[model samples]
Structures are given as C-alpha cells and as structure tokens.
Target: MQKLNLSQSLSQKLSPQQIQFIKLLQVPTAELDTRIEEELEINPALEEGKEEETEQSQDDDFEDSYDDDLGRDDHELNLDDYLDDEYSGYKMQGDGNYNSDDDDREIPISSQTSLHEQLITQLNFLKLDDRQKIIGQQLIGSIENDGYIRRDLEAIINDLAFSQNIETDIDELEEILRKIQTFDPAGIAARTLQECLIIQLERKEHPDDPVVKHALLIVQDCFEEFTKKHYSKIQKRLDLDEEGIKDAVNLITRLNPKPGGASDGLVRTQYIIPDFILTNNGGKLEVSLNSKNAPELRISRSYADMFDAYDKSDKKDKKLKDTVTFVKQKLDAAKWFIDAIKQRQNTLLRTMEAILNYQKEFFIDGDETNLRPMILKDIAERIDMDISTVSRVANSKSIQTEFGVYPLKYFFSEGIATDSGEDVSNREVKSVLQGMVDAEDKKRPLSDDKLVKMLNKLGYNIARRTVAKYREQLQIPVARLRKEL
Candidate 1:
C-alpha cells in the first residue's frame, strides 16, 4: 500500500486571462455594467472612454509608445489586441463594438409596493398592544416573497421566545397571523397553495352566485380531488349534474392560484435585458449583440503619464523603481482586463453568428418547426472552437428577435430521427406533443399512451415514457390533472 509509483499525466489548465474571458463571455447584458464597475474600482488604469488618438496617429504612436523591453516583465497588453479583430469579426454590425438603440435606464421601477412592505403598511390600521404589535410584525416578517407564511406556528413561537425575548404561545401567534391574512392581495399570510387559493375564494364570497359557493365548497371539501382535476369524483361527491359541475369547475379554474404574483396585473418585478438582437429584413437576418456587452474602455491617460515619467526618470533609486513597478503592474492589469473584454466580444459575436446561420430559417420565419437539430458540438465544429466555449456563450445568453426574446439554449435541440429516416429537432416533437394536448377534447383529455400513438402516427415513433418526459419538460401536467369538465 505504501509503494511509490511514477506516473506522467498531461492535463490542460486555463490561464488567468482565458478564465477571465470565459467568465466575461457568459455574463448577460444585465450584469455587464456591474462587472465593468468592479474592474474600474480595482484597476485605476482602466477607465470608461474611447481612445482620443486618430487611427493613423495612434498606430504611429503605438510604435514609439513603448520599446520591446519596456513593460515586458509586467507582461500583459491590450490596445493592439483590440485592433486585431481576432474572432472573424462581426457580420450584422459594422464593428464588434456594437451599441444598442434602446437605453436600459428607460426601464422603470415597480409602481406597486412589494409584498412585505404592503403587509407592514396594513398592520398600522390594527388596534393592538405593544406585545401584540411585535408578534404581528414578526408574523409579517415570516411571510415569504410569495405572500405565504410557510413557517409553522410552533417554529415562530420558539423563535420569538428564544431570539426576541418575547414569550408568545402558538394561539397568540395564530391570532396575529389570521389578522395579517385579512390584508390585501387576498392571500398574504397563507401557509400553503391550498390555503392561498381558499383565502382568495373566501374573499370573493357572493351569496347569490351559486358557482362562487360551489367553488368554495370544492376548494374546502375536495381540495385534493380538485387539484387532481378529478371533476367526476367532485361531481359524484357533491351530487352535481354535468352542466352544474362544469360551471362550478370553470369558476374554480378562474381563481388566482398565485395571488401574490400579478394581482389583476398590478404588480411586477425583474426585467430581462437581452444579450443580442436578431431582425429579419424581408429575408436576410441581421444579428447584433447588446450595446452594453461591448463597452468602450481605454487605459487612463494620467496613469499612462505616471508610468511614462517613471520609465524615463534618471532617478534609479530602489524606491523609485518600486514605484515604477507598482505603476507598471496596475497598467498591465488594466490592459489585461481590456484585452479580455475584447476577446469576449469576439467570441460572443462568432458564437452568435454561427448559431444564427445554423438556425437561420427559424429566425427568418419565426417558426419553431423550422429550427434544425443543433447542439453545442455542432456549433463548435462550425465556429472551430471548443464545445465548452460554445456552451459558455449559449448558457445565459439571450437574443431579441423581431418575433420575441429567446435564450440561446432555445435554438440548440437534440436530434430525433423519424420513421421516414429523417433527423429532426426534438423541439419539433415537443411542438407536435403540445399541439395535440392543446387541441385535445377536454372532457376526455388524451393520456400519454394516446399521445404516443398520435406522435407515432405523425412519424415520431417515440415511446410513452419519452412522451411523458417531453410533457414534463413542457411543464404540462399528466392526464388526470389535465382533465377538465
């Protein structure tokens, strides 16, 4: 067991700049500003602006700016690499330094107050003693982003006693929670999805509306059955005929399952900034990366001047050289960052262009069926890059098309060969599966077995389990749950 063995194993490791380039490549348009700001804060030499020199003059100055030996030990460089146009350059845009027509600053903050803030505001109207108010505040705090207090009453009681030095029982906490539940957005302090739905239904209680009363009954008495969409069981249990049950079921379907999210289209949070934009001009497709992705960065002139002063100084004291070294190090870091950004832009453009060319038909017609079978390796081969490199670009990157915004992953689908000896995209199969479900008779919704037959008829030749997998991927519920009156 203690025997020594000599072995040689070759492993490739990414350099620091290469790693940086990969990270920067994957960052979406939304977070690019934050990343650039972080670099600016850390590297004094790096600043946000285009270089001031004219192209020809800058080329001439670049020669005399620094000799071969100058800054060689410091190592890193950028400006010349940027001008190299490394990765096949861009096609849709004039330069890889692409800019956006729309300003990100135009996006507005949420007009409606957040869920917890809204809950806290409602607590002001309640007439409570100090102890009661404190408990009420804790309960409100316990409420999650979805407006549900998922924590058990026992847990809250323990938390109050041990942490807040407030001796509170389960009963008192429940009273406060009940009061909080009565607040706006209808389902604020519910414990579960069932409870949230019941709260919304009870709030909309109407004496004359028979469907409303039946809906409440369905939620309270047959929650499990209602959730499974076992409409037949609910009808038999409640002794309701076809028409009556259908009306009641339809009303239940209309209830807000997620009351905390989009209450009558009055609340919203989060916005997605697309990384690229694709447009169809008659038949030709134009693709460009987001403007924020390509920032105009240049080394600070003042920092460069300081370095130059140090470089030419006759004072060769240890302290002077040390200061020069520090200046050179910072300058090198800034140059490295700038170079990484340029390479990131080049890689992104190359990757997007390859994907655009591969999925050209889909982008042109805005048709999912037109999307060919494409994978990371397929793109890697086309662009002559590593599969992992292509993957990094497609991972979080999104493109805005004339049709809509779509993630790069959306265009890359696995191949599924048909009985006719033709390979098609898995998306094509999913589309057929979705269409079948969408057009199925709700009274007797098609089961996975039935779906398999339909898909087989369409020349897919997929198994039932495969159909189930695709259905789950699409987030569509099973036959029993999908059943409707």
Candidate 2:
C-alpha cells in the first residue's frame, strides 16, 4: 500500500471581489454597454435612470421618508427603510470613459436567422410533401455551421424514424441530402470534400469549358495527386502547357471548399472593441483608455439606503434578519463590482500608458524600425503586477491609434541583439521580410536561403530556418510555389 500525505496549505486565495475585478478587466469597451445592460437586468436593486431624477427621487423617497420613519417608530420597524436610497446617480459619459459618442456603429440585438434557418427557408420552396418537408427540415437541422453533415446515413435514418416519427430509408435520406447540397451556396450540405467539389462542378455556369471540365475530371479521378501538387501528371494527362495548368489550378482555387461559409447568415460577426485610444498631438503621443468601455459605475444608492435602514432597525425581527442579510449581500456584491470596474479601468490605463510612453518614438514616426522589443513582463514590471495579469489584459484588448486599430499584443515583440549590441524587434525583421517578398521578382522568386543571405548583408544575422519560419508566418509559400510563369 502506498502512503499518502494530505496537507492543507494556507495560501491567499482570490476573494470574490478580486474575481469580479478580473472579470471586469477582461471585458473590452465595445461590449461594455451590453455588459452594463446585463447587470442592470440581473440586479433589480441597481436601476438606470436620468442623473437628476435618480438623485432627487432617491433622496426624497429613502432619506426623507424612510430614514425618519425608522429612527422614530418603535413598531417592529419595517425593513423597507433599508431598501431606500438617500441620493444616487449613474453618470453616463458622452465622450470618454467607456462611451465614445464618435463611434456610430450600433450592434442590433435582434437575432438574425442562422444558416440552418436560411436552409430551411430554401427547403420550404421545394415541391416536397408535408412528410418530405419534415424530413428535409430534420436533415437541414442536422447539418452543422460548416454545412457538412458528418453523421452517417444509418444514424440519420434512425433519427428520422425515432425522433420525427417518420420512417425513411438511408438511400432516400441521402438523396434528400444531395438535393440540399445543390442549393444556392454551391458546396453546402455536402457529406465529403469530394461531394462538395462535384456539387460545385455541376453548378458551374460553363461546365463544358475545357479547363473546368479537365479540373472536374482531375478532382474525380486524381484528387490525391492534384492535392499533392503533381502538376506534371495532370498536365501530361490533359496535354496542357504550363499556362493552361496554371489556369486550371486557378479555376480549382475559385471553387468554395466550404460552400456554407459564403452565406453571412451562417456566421457570427465578432466586433473588436479597443481598450485604449492613441493619438498624435503636436509631436507628442497621447494615450487614453476608451472611457466608453468603463461606464460610470458605483454602488447602487438603493442598496446603500437599505444598509443605512438595516443599521437603524431593531435587530431581533426574523423578517428583518433575512432582509438585512440580503441587503448586505447585495451591497457587498455591488461594491465589489464597482471596485472591479474601477480597478480594471486603472489597470488598462496604466498598462496602455506605459506602452505608449515606451513606444512613443515608434508612434510618432509610424515606422517599424523605431519599435523597441518589449513584452508583457516589461509592462507588468513597470505597473508592479503579475505577468499573467498583464497578459490577460493584453490578450483580447485592442488599441485604436491614428494608424489603425491593433491588438495590444501587436506592440510587444522579443528583442534580437545586433552586432553593435543594439536590440531590434522581431517585428522589424518581419517587416523587412515582407518588403523583400513584395519587391522580389515573381519570375525568379527568392528562396529562403537567398532571403537569409540578403538579410545577413543588411546586418541582421538571421538563420535560413528562421527566415523560412518567418516567411511561412507571413503566409508566403515556398520559392517553388511562389514561382510564376
């Protein structure tokens, strides 16, 4: 038997307050409004109203009415006093502080019809009977967002029989699935890549065009070889020149590999909200957190009133005990939430301010050459926070500079030492690589080794493998693939 030792270590754990802070830190400005709305919906004690009316009503209702009643009356004092506010105001800033009025884009909340919905809509136009339509609807629902139906025919057959109470043969279901694949988005509802390509080929406007017809034949008979870029075999079989092969390859590339992706209805748009805004003001770099992301948040005045009333109320009433507990819990939560929001705003500002200050030269010049190699640890050390915390802040957050909106992570790069003992950012190296590729002769593409040599001559001692890796990262293919007739 193995002896096991169990020991409880006393380590400082994050309080709920701290957890709430981290959560708030992660929310970007673009989604802050929605998050605020969500909070207002969940916490009834937290109300949203105009600044003036909110203050006056809370003071008159809670302080003047409830506070007096609670202090004077000995009658098993009503706990309602604990729920009234003295004065509360939620100041929604118009220009800065989590709400930039300049950004006119408004995200509509109405749910758009999804890809499945659109498919079902098309299915409705088909001349199928009620039963067939039901089967088609079931099939459409089974197709995933990518528009592929990975489930086997037997599984779909059983689903049709048991779930929908409609018996259907495997062959019948496959036929219906094929019909669905033939819908407007050429390759949608396909069971396999082969099927998708075939469906697209069938829908081609000029199906008899020699290049397309040859490409279709290649897909049908030699998909494996074609995928491996065995262009010689394809050319020999079709008796086509290098130019003809290039055109055939171009035609194949034009076909949608995933037909379902063409329908915007099938995809969810991700909106990026920047946490910081950087602008150049008279040769100085100015940085500010997008205040719109950090709404004017505070403890709901009503909760504070409730706390006051609870403090004044007689402590023995059973009803008042639960209400008091409830008030304390909510007040604690509200306070934590507000504190978290404030901390998040402060942290973001501090981090971004450090970045702007550190990269002031780069921002002012708008040149990659001026970028100093910096990382999350550098910012974390500057701000006196853990590296992980800085990373979390930088991960999804974006900054809107006069140049363009970029992810905060984009500014950070590792340094490489130069011969003169100067550090250079890898970003600068990538920029150089991109420039070289852009200026390289297409007819005689530069190989990774040649590119490495070119960089070495330019005083950057980078290895060939590193050059290849960076080139691949930039989405540039190998020299052979880059070669053009």
Candidate 3:
C-alpha cells in the first residue's frame, strides 16, 4: 500500500558567501595573501587594483549596476539557463596578472645541509656488511631533533623487522648506536641526558684531568644528585672538596646539552607578520589593520563594460545569451566576494577597537601587570557581535605595540580575587610568582607550599596546587631541581 504524506519543515542554512567569509576571517595575516591569490585565480570578474573612478563614484556605479542586475526577478528576465559549480555547459576563464615582485619578496633558500643529512653522510665512512649498514641508517633515522634516541630499543627492533624486513636484536642495535654516538658532533645519538654528557665528557681533550675525571664521575654515578643540585651529597660520596666539585660543575655546564641544536644556526629564521598594528601616539593608542589586509580589489572594468553591452542588446541569439549567463554568474560572485571582504574588514576593526579600548592602560604603560581580566563575552558585548566572532579574531590575530608584538589573546586572562575586594589578572599573580622565584637563593629554592604562603602574605589567597600550576606554566622547575652546587 502507498500513502501520500505532506509536511513542512523550517531550517536555517548559511549561503556559500557566508561560509567563505567565515573561513577568510580565520586566515592569519601570513596566509591571507595566499587566499586572495586563489580567489583571484578562480573568479574572473573579481580583479585586483581599484577602479579609476573616485571611491564615491565606484560605490554609486556598484549600487546602480550590480544591485539592479543581482536583484532581478524572472518576471523581468529568465535565468532558467545559467552556469554553476556543477554545470559543464560553459566555462568562465580570465587571464591573471602575476606580480613580478612576489618572487623577490620570498625568503631566500638556504644551501646548508640539515643535521640528519650530515649524519647520513658520516655513515658512508663506516665499513659494515649490507645488513649492518641498513640497521645503522635506520638507527640514525630514529634519532630525534635533539639528537637523543628516546624510542625503546625493542620497539625499534620490531619496527625494523616489520617495516624494513631486517631481523636484529637489542644488543646489535646498541653496539651500532655506540658507534653512531662517536660521530663528529661528540654526543649525537645518546639515549638519555646522562649518556649524552658522558659521551661528550669521554671525548674531551684532557679526559685524565682531575676536573674532567670528576665531571665524568658526577655525570655517570651521581647524575640524580647532579640534576637535583645535591653537590654536597655527591662530594661526601666521591670524597671531593667544594673547590673540586665547583670546577667539575662549571666544566659540565660548559658542555653543550643539545648537540643537534648547534646545527640550527644554518636554518632559516621564522618571522611573525602581525594582523594588527597598535601605535602609542603620546599615550593615545591608534589601532589599524595590516596594510596587506587592505588590498585594492574591484570589479574588472572590462567585464562591467561587457555587461553594459549585453544589456543594450535584445539578442535572441543563443551565443549572445550564453555569454550573458557566464558574465552574470561571475559578476554576482565578484560582488558577493567584495561585500564579504568589506564586512570582514569592518568586523576586524570593530572587534580590535573594542579590545584596544578595554586594555588601554596596559598598552599605554607597557606593563603586563596592568592587564585586565577579560574574556570573549566582554568584547562581544562592546562590539555587538557573537562571542565566537571575538574568539576567531583573538585566536589568530596579533598586535604590534611599543613594548612588543603579542598575540591578541595574550591580553585576555582569567581573574584572581585579592583580599582587598579587587579583581586582578592571573598574569599579575604569575609575574609576582616569577619575581619571587627569580630572587630566591638557588641552593634554597622555594617549594610550592612556601610559594603559596608567601603569596598569601602578599594578599593573593590562592591554593598550593594553583601555585604549582603557575610555576609549571612559567617553565620553573621543582625546588629540588632549582638547587645549585
């Protein structure tokens, strides 16, 4: 049996233009140029460079032409025959203007070899059997960027068997690893910090020297004590005086902890392109978007003239009609994109203006302690936008100030309550905590409990766990690790 059913349902959907704008809003300044280039390649009617007419004239012409054409109903002209993304009837094509300076603007390529490549080059000097050579290469590949092989030997053996069809045990791998550790870098493939130090210490020019021997002993036997700065305990066990231990500690400290990092000098540096530029003109902060963000884009003048010609003709010819359909689609897309760009520019400025106004004190004085406790909701209310919009801006955007270039989100922090009934940014508390740690005696570092008590006396009543969390965020080690010889 068949039954006919009728129901009405209502749902909201975003148009293609809206989806594109949302994506564009999230593109950081580094990538916005790429996105614009892609759009220019695809959309023929959308071209770069402003129209020769004045801004007022361009707006008047856009309002007159695009609005009239885009707003047409079927009663005036039929759109039954048109091209779309899936439609293969007609193809729209436009020649792109490639900027010659773009090539010059790119960062120059480096000719220096990377660390792993150098390791492989050294492997050529080893005289091993075919199987042994393969295992050696695999071991070198397993080494991390920091030149340490943290992976388990057994796991690597299994991987070699499964992936490379090489059957080897841990002893064979360990033997080969010892050879790799002796490579030119002094401590290339050590498994741990102690091993890395010992490898370097053994390679020292005067290993028999008293200071060198003591340094080796400290790294090999008293590594736990060395890391915890328990020099007195190490001295008692090794029967070394304070002067000898101090010299040994100084020698060990002079050795490079990260051998692989030495090769990074040849690597190219990364530069951050800020999305917003904030200048303090005599304490009056002026906010502006990056110049790259405000590219001069306009409707292609030739395409506009073609549309005018098409409108003048009462052509019943199919060829003329086909051209009209293609032009209409491109024009519509161009106008939508232009409008979206304008909206995105306005939205970015509005959101950034709200943030600048809210954090004016911090910007003017260049003091992080003055930063207020702010969240997305606070900016959203001021700018009359959604919290999500503010989040999108804050997540990827950065501002260059007199003090430094900072990510926009760095200004927004969680609040902590003080005993005086005032709210302060958690960043302020972290700053204070860091200051105390910096001033503490290295041999007597303050524990988290002590830090909490000190902070309480300073009027910030936070828990011990919170103190530990903040210390970890600041990259400060535990009290034991902070001790010195």
TM-score of each: 0.82, 0.80, 0.81
| Candidates ranked, most accurate by lDDT first | 3, 1, 2
Q: Which digits, one per residue and each the tens of the lDDT, describe model 1 over residues 1-485?
A: 69999999999999887888888888888999999988876766667778645222222333364332122223223322232333232222443233454233476555676676777788988999888888998898887665677888899988888878999887778888888889987877899888887887778858468877887788889989888777788999998888888887787677666656753334655688998878777787888878988899877655565555543454556666665566678777777788889898889889999999988888887899988999899999998999998988898889998788999999999888899998899999999899999999877889999999988888986988889999999999988777666
lDDT of each: 0.77, 0.74, 0.81
| Superposition TM-score, candidate 2 onto the true structure | 0.80
RMSD after Cα superposition, model 1:
8.0
TM-score ranking of the models: 1, 3, 2
Model 3, 1-485: lDDT tens per residue?
Answer: 99999999999999988987888888888898888878777876777776445222223434574643222212222333322233331123432334556546877667888888888888889988889888998998888887888999999899899988999998899999888998968888998888999999999998799999999999999999888788889999999999999999999999878777744523456689998899877767899989988777777655555555554466786877887778768887887777777778898899989989998898898898999999899999999988998999899999888788999889888889899989999999999999999999987889999999999999997999999999999999999888776
RMSD of 2: 6.7
Task: Provide the lDDT at 99 for model 2.
Answer: 36
Off by over 4 Å in 2: 1-8, 47-111, 129-138, 151-170, 241-244, 262-271
Check candidate 2 and list the clashing pairs: 82-306, 97-291, 97-292, 98-291, 98-292, 98-293, 98-294, 99-291, 99-292
Give lDDT for model 1. 0.77
Tell me the tens digit of each residue's lDDT in model 2 across 1-485.
99999998888899888888888777767777888777755654454432222222233434553332222222233456444532232323431122344256676686766787788889988899999998898888777767788888788888888888998897788778877877777888888887788788878889889888877887887787677667788778878788777887788878888766734544667777777788788887788878686576544544554556565567787767877777666655655565677788888888888888888888887787899999988998898999988888888798887777888888899886666778899899999999998899987889998998898888787888888888988999988777654
